[model samples]
Target chain A: MKKSSCSLLILVLLWSNGVFGQDLLNLLEAEQKDENQYAPSAFMMTRIAFGHSTEVRPQNVLDVFVANRFWNTPEESTQSFVADRMSSRIALEYAISDRLTFGAGATTFDGLFDAHLKYRAALQRNGDGWPITLTLFQNMSYDSSPIADQSVSDDFSDRLSFTSQILVSKRFNKNFSLQLAPTLVNRSLGLSAADPTSIFALGAGVRYKLGPHVSFVSEYYQVFNPLESRTTFDPIAFGVNWELGDLMLQFMLTNSWFMVEDAFITRTPNNFNFRNPNLNFGFNATYVIHFKNKLKK
Target chain B: MNKVLLLLTTLVLTLSNDSSDKVICRQGSVSFFSYTSVENIKAQNNQVSSIIDFESSKIAVSMLMNAFVFEKALMREHFNESYIESDIYPKATFEGEILDFEPAMEGAQIRIVKGLFTMHGVAEELEIKTKIEKSGSTFTLTGSFETLVESYDINIPPLLAGNIAKTISVDFRFEYEPYEEK
Candidate 1:
């Protein structure tokens, strides 16, 4: 009886192994046909947007822009430009993981700072047939100036601001995707009575694929401050992203440009006198290179 | 009973024959190109592999989603987290076979492959041209194809539409060694 029972167990084990093996094999075959058939060596995208909105009150139209004159021309001065009536910024993004990314950029009218850090985390994915993504982002800005003057009390300083945003995006098709982010802003320093670190902002953006190497992007953001009576700021931007093998270029335009905290945060046109103020209009450009490591699969 | 025996015998022979074919794929430095004019932005997956059994019309392929490195690491992260959701669906696979395969010389030859490809939980019929090369104790296979992201329900954000390509092309080359039969 013991021998018979042992044989039965062996038979069952063999049968189950065969069944499961076949199932696994079948699954493997099926999965091969799915999207992204190859284990990609790496993925990258360069983005840019350019757009502008006029202030509702003509006198309130303040544009802040920061320009890098020495960027493309060797003879150009290294000093940055400051315009308080209109602005623009250009940024480049890189993906470190499937859910996290790092980004840096420079703006036209905000401040002299030429870089920032952006970390995004995906809380949910649209894998199970649902075309929705929930993501959280933390954007931090650094001061651009080497000189530190506490008396300056400009928006650009040794300060840190945190933005908590929830993003929901849906790909309408392979060529197009749309996303909406509702965010809460918290700042360590308050520059104005109208500047509420706890203001609410809304962001809407879209991505469209045109071909194998190019795409277009656009985004709009509106921030509403409840503490400051009837104070709101709307910034719009549009741009084009070009990918050349390993190199990516992004170019964009806008009316509220600043690279660092003080550039846009303190010098945005909304906070300055609209009339007889500096108005700057220009584009921001970014280039990126990717490095990849091979994996043994 | 005779027919059942014959079927079992054929299955055994086919299985044994497949054990002799192997396929390996690798991607070292893959790249992506995004163009606004041609609207041809594409991320190329360099690491891809698969094995095929000509006698049985069976095939298997596998890839690591995280392996897709990008020029901008941030974009890679967003793709894994926000787009492909790499944590939940870490890898993509295909398990199917050529509908009709006839054994040929032990070297490279052109062959037609037909099978069902499942992606993003949806399965679709795929007919592609494949090259099979057999050299003594080794075999190699190569194939290329393209797929529309919409077919798999991959959504691109409107703000990002201009940067991502609608159709992604897939190219593959595999090297295999015989699996010694016991």
Candidate 2:
């Protein structure tokens, strides 16, 4: 009788395993078709100080931005803290997917028209595998204004400049995230007649949350290129980001009047010494709109 | 040793028999709606899991907090990253008993479920009205309840006080089948 009862239990277990798993498989598959699929935004703000962040917006979402940069540096005299020379950039970005984002803008500085595409290459979870989040950013720009070296940049290709960066970031906790970006800028025609066509730089940024809607953000770039021949100083920025619903507003003290990666990374005008109070005060605002397609399944 | 062996055998038999009285739902669905004069917010999660024991009148449920999806992508992000903090509290769960519940062979009954629902690392006592539909072998349960967002310690800023409702309404439904140990 004991053996018979044991056999009966085994049969019930086997039957239930097959039945339960199969039924659940079917239900899960059916639900997945209509379920929402999305990932988290690593950074709260849209722009990580004149460059794209590792965070990618969700699909079918558009972000419109206005960034104003005042042309001055803190190393100058304190008489002109907020300079009158300001360049404005209006950019619009759309997320093709959770992994890829594309944007285009026009900067008043150098009459630059720029476009960029940033992709989230890999995401790191808290486990033994994949320790860091990696992102790839590429920006291309064309200076439409007249060039001093007309003989070198007469052609359209000569007017083009590109900046490619690899952003490596890690979210240490809810309050802090750190990022390191190895950047490369390639200009078909260098600014000076004797300058090299390409230059390399390292960029670092940090975001620390102070409240639910406010965070401290900053970024610095150190160029490895020769300082003697360099026409522009390295970029330094310190800012605060305020998030409210779908809108984000940012105010910063920076050293450049450029808002695109190609323009800002290679052509800032300030050093980190802060010898004087001639800091350029700027502000940026971004609003995101979501599009939903519910008419058809 | 012999007594221990006999006791183990008896326990295994009892557990095996209890499996027939135990109902499990792996694809249960839970949703919530918040309506205010200024705005209305809704989210749903279909990956919820629940189990009910007919003999013991016990009910338990668990679901991933990140699985909750909203109609708007930004809302979903805020729901996980801002409000729920899915990274820290990845799952929400509930364990409760049906007060004065008596199993029926093939009928429907109204019951009260008294339990502790835990979300965002906070737990609160919940009492919800539930409708249980039982057939020969299939069982279906549906319920809805109202709770305050502050009970879960989720802070809403004053700026958004008008957009989000003061009280939230939660809804749950599950269809259960006899559980298989394997």
Candidate 3:
């Protein structure tokens, strides 16, 4: 009787494995088509702190961005509750295609107007498909600040600057991502006669996700060759990003006073030191709008 | 000796029934719509997989949560990251039996499909009214159902609660061909 019961138990187990309804579902799942899944949210927004990340706005979408920086001068009254000076930048960015994005903005402190074109060359996949994301960025800025020197500010070409960068990024996991940007800057006329017309810099950025809607972001740019005529320091910023439904808000601290890449990456004069009170409190807000239905199956 | 023979015969019958009575759909479509005063969001996934077993009147549906395509890319990102948390629960599935389902039904027949629908690591019993059409060797099944967002443990923060609907409507269609193991 024991032998017969043992054989019966074996039969039941084998039958359950093949004949159960769950097995049918498993079979269907096994034959499901393999779909390409791309890594999502390498960076929460287009800007990682003060520098641009390897992210492009979606096609046919418009982004309205506003950034502000506030700081106190050394001679400012200590009685003031907060910073005494403020700088702001307002921008409108639009994605023409899935891989191409363009934006233009105006800044208040330097009276600078800037425009940029970004192209996404490659996107990282979820698994082992593509290890890194690659993007190319080009920006042009015109200084519109009122200057007494006619030779410096009168000519449109002399007041212009250009920046070119290749942004390479990798999303190691859902919570961490890293990016490196090799940059080249060109100025029609340097601020000082001894300053070089061209500058080379390397920027690094990191994002650590704390939650689905929040992340800690930091960026640093190191100039290869410093300006000979003026004291220049590398730009560094750290911030927290909060994402709402259609808007993103970033709060940051940085030693750079400028908003645009042409000015900040090459001309930042303050060092990010613990003892120095050079850090500026800044915030950025971005709103996105989708123009039309561009869904792809 | 007779008992051993009986066990072997039952195994052979079950294995043969698995292949002969099954129909499969590799390219099915499932779409969901959320209507709200603030915004109306809609997404669709065409890479759904489903199977129907006529011998047992059983049906199964499986789809990748990340496969859903929304009108806006940001909406898709939010759906995966915030709403469904696709990293933790990558697939949504349904396994159920068809009531009064006849493989030899002449024309379009309306049937009730009762199943456990699982999404976002939560499972709930569901009954969907489906329209099934059989012509030659092809079987087409189409249906729509309404499910509450709360039933799936999907939490929308109070601040953005007005942007999404409390209840969502889902529609699906599958065209099944004869299953042949490749």
Chain A fold similarity by TM-score, each prediction: 0.55, 0.78, 0.91
lDDT of 3 by residue, A171-220 (tens): 88878999999999998554777788899999999999887788999999
Tell me, per candidate, how large a share of the native contacts it keeps: 0.10, 0.15, 0.48
Q: Which sequence of candidate numbers ranks them by TM-score, best first?
A: 3, 2, 1
* Better TM-score candidate (1, 3): 3
**Of the pair 1 and 3, which is ahead by DockQ?**
3
Supply the global lDDT for candidate 3. 0.88
Off by over 4 Å in 1: A1-117, A123-130, A142-162, A188-195, A226-232, A259-267, A270-282, A295-297, B1-182
Question: Mind giving the per-residue lDDT tens digits that candidate 3 earns over B57-80?
Answer: 889999999889998888888888
Sliding window of 10 residues with minimal summed lDDT for model 1 chain A = A52-61
Stretches of candidate 3 off by over 4 Å are A1-22, A76-82, A150-154, A273-277, A295-297, B1-18
CAPRI-wise, candidate 3 is acceptable
TM-score of chain A of 2: 0.78
- Local accuracy by lDDT, each model: 0.49, 0.76, 0.88
**lDDT of model 1 at residue A36?**
31
Per-residue alpha-carbon lDDT of model 1 for B1-182, expressed as tens digits? 44544565566545554544533333322334544654444455666555555444567666666667554443565566456755546656676665446555766678777766665556667777988777875666677776676786664667667667776667666676543333
Model 2 per-residue lDDT tens digits across residues B1-182: 44544565576557535566677788889999999998788888887887776655777787878777777777877777778887778778787788888766468889899988889999899899999898877788898999999888886778888888978999999998887655
